[model samples]
Target: MISQLTHLNWFSVLCAFIPYFILGGLWFTVFFGNPYKTSLGKGNETLPNSPIFIAGPAICCLIITITTAMLIYALNVNTLSGALEFAMVAGIGYLVTNTVNIAINPNIPRPIFYSVISGTYHLVGITIVCIIIVAMK
Candidate 1:
């Protein structure tokens, strides 16, 4: 349903996706690949095409839905309140994603180094966009 973020623009859809796209790319291609391979207990075998084969699509879909919903109500709704709600929902999503990663890789040390920063950067970006949407009106 929610496919874009533009109505109220509490947080631009493109901006939201930027962090996810970049961080996800790095995660799967670089650092995460190694850990993921080890977790699967397999060698360097190419991934296949299936719902479970590539999980990134599901994640991306989530990001799009959340931001698009935020945008849809931003204009007709209260900007500050909407922004807060958006932030909370998005922050929760970020936390859940990170926590899930840590849960999967229990051995990884606490306090994610670069990945945590990546999420924080995304939060800051969303916050800025929220502020911009409020101020622009």
Candidate 2:
């Protein structure tokens, strides 16, 4: 399957990267950062320092990108139909997320504004990635 994606064009590469970077950037930076930090029992202002701090997000984007690329390549999905499939997939993630939260952060509200914002952006990210691949095809 990796071999399949290797034949993708530069645009496909962008499809992989943009969603990961932009969505993760906005999600972590603006949406979930505050609440997530606090949930970890930290103050509102402490920021992660060190090279790992900066690189961690980049690594996340890379992973998501590669994974998305592979999904498209493997499933033979190609549709510029906007948010449908992505929303469904992300919705599935939310269910899994809720289940995991039940075990880990059971006291934390699923309705926490940051959780919603984080999931929403990630949803849009996957949507855009799927749309881009479909459009290119």
Candidate 3:
């Protein structure tokens, strides 16, 4: 793990993190803004333009990108097929599941709908991160 960290391509990690973070912004605000708000029972209420909303997800994306880069380097996943496989496994197993788990609570009015929206964002975001990490290897 330590060796993998040392050998990790910092450029690729940055490249991947940027898109993942941006995707979260666009996903919630542009693509599914109305639906996402509905799922959260917010209705027509405008989302708070809080720093935590941006900073929190940015931090999460950075950690996810770095971890994905490390795993790609450590596992020697250079091929597109290997990258796709790894992305699917990690995306579905961890990212999507976790999103769904978090949505399944009293706060979210429509847990399944919320899960599909948020979970899919994570799934696609992680896939992009994985591919970038492997391609830059």
Candidate 4:
């Protein structure tokens, strides 16, 4: 499988991954910033300025993007339609299901709201990445 890595278009993968970083910034700051804070009941708390906080999610986003790209290659999803459908199914089947499991746990606050927002974010993000990768490839 290691040799199979060459089959993937790395530049396309990079292009696909970039939007997640951009969307995340807009989603958590410009677009849903206030709403997300309100949902978390952290309306008064300032956004964390620590490098760890910033870098952590950035790293996670990279990982997620890389994983998505790998999956696309592994599944032989090259067509635009296949990429879109596969990405959506993967998002719902994997990401949303896993998130829902965690969100529904009693320990998680605002379980429903949190799941809706975060899950949707993953779905949208994955879809965007898939479209870019397929189109570019």
Q: What is the C-alpha RMSD of each candidate to the true structure, in Å?
A: 6.8, 3.9, 0.8, 1.8
Candidate 4 has its poorest 10 consecutive residues by lDDT at 1-10
Pairs that collide, model 1: none
* Cα-based lDDT at residue 124, candidate 1: 52
Per-prediction TM-score, please?
0.42, 0.66, 0.97, 0.87
Residue-wise lDDT of candidate 2 within 1-137, one digit each (tens)? 77866766657767667766776666766867776666445535777668886688677656665666666666666665433575357545753365345435555444354455555556666666666666775
Evaluate residue 71 in candidate 2 and report its C-alpha lDDT on the 0 to 100 scale: 64
Candidate 4 or 3, higher TM-score = 3
Q: How many residue pairs clash (N, CA or C atoms closer than 3 angstroms) in each of the candidate models, in the order given?
A: 0, 0, 0, 0
Error (Å) of candidate 2 at residue 72 is: 1.3
Which model, 1 or 3, shows the larger TM-score? 3
Ranking by lDDT: 3, 4, 2, 1
lDDT of each: 0.51, 0.60, 0.92, 0.79
> On lDDT, who's better, 1 or 4?
4
The list of candidate 3 runs beyond 4 A from truth reads none
Kindly list the per-residue Cα lDDT of model 3 for residues 13-126, writing each as its tens digit: 999999999999999989999999999999789978989999999999999999888888888899989999999999999999999899989989999999999999999999
Give the per-residue lDDT digits (tens) of candidate 1, residues 29-54. Answer: 58566555444443367655576634
Best by TM-score: 3
